[model samples]
Target: MTEKKLKVDLSVPFPTEREAQIACGTLSVDSEPKRGGVKKELVVKGNVLNIHFEALEARMMRVGMNSFFDHLNLVIETMEKFGPPEK
Candidate 1:
């Protein structure tokens, strides 16, 4: 029997489109591991960062989300400390 997938959608709003794009680009660089059984997609829509996650099991989903959030928190903190990058 085929296993059902668990999915999650997350939307994070930034002060500017530039910041959203930066976060998307930065986070997208680290793709999910092949054996992790998790898939992640990141996109920027205006000032919002959209994240979609899918996993074969709840444990996989939770672990993937926790790792992503840790990276996300660091990204937000860095943006807050250094401000936007120069064009």
Candidate 2:
């Protein structure tokens, strides 16, 4: 028999499984739900909280900053789109 595996697009990852205990959490990420993913233990170099949404972060960083206000606004927008700061 063959074991089917899931393709985990870590593009969006919850802080912990506890955060996924409800629908408003990571559960709402995708309706189909990502199942059968092989759990891999990782030794993070630094505090790796929500490292999956990197492309989104890069997109935010690409915005042109004409002044301090523009940069602040962009940062605020990014925080709103992404979650809170990692510990």
Against the true structure, whose lDDT is highest? 1
Write candidate 2's Cα lDDT for 1-87 as tens digits: 854433222222334433223212322233221342223222222223222111122223222112222533454466557775554
Off by over 4 Å in 1: none
Cα TM-score per model: 0.95, 0.25
**Local distance difference test, each candidate:** 0.95, 0.31
lDDT computed for candidate 1:
0.95
Model 1's TM-score against the true structure: 0.95
lDDT of 1 by residue, 1-87 (tens): 988899999999999999999999999998999899999999899999999999998999999999999999999999999978776
By summed lDDT, the worst window of 10 consecutive residues in model 2 runs over: 49-58
RMSD values, in order shown: 0.9, 13.1
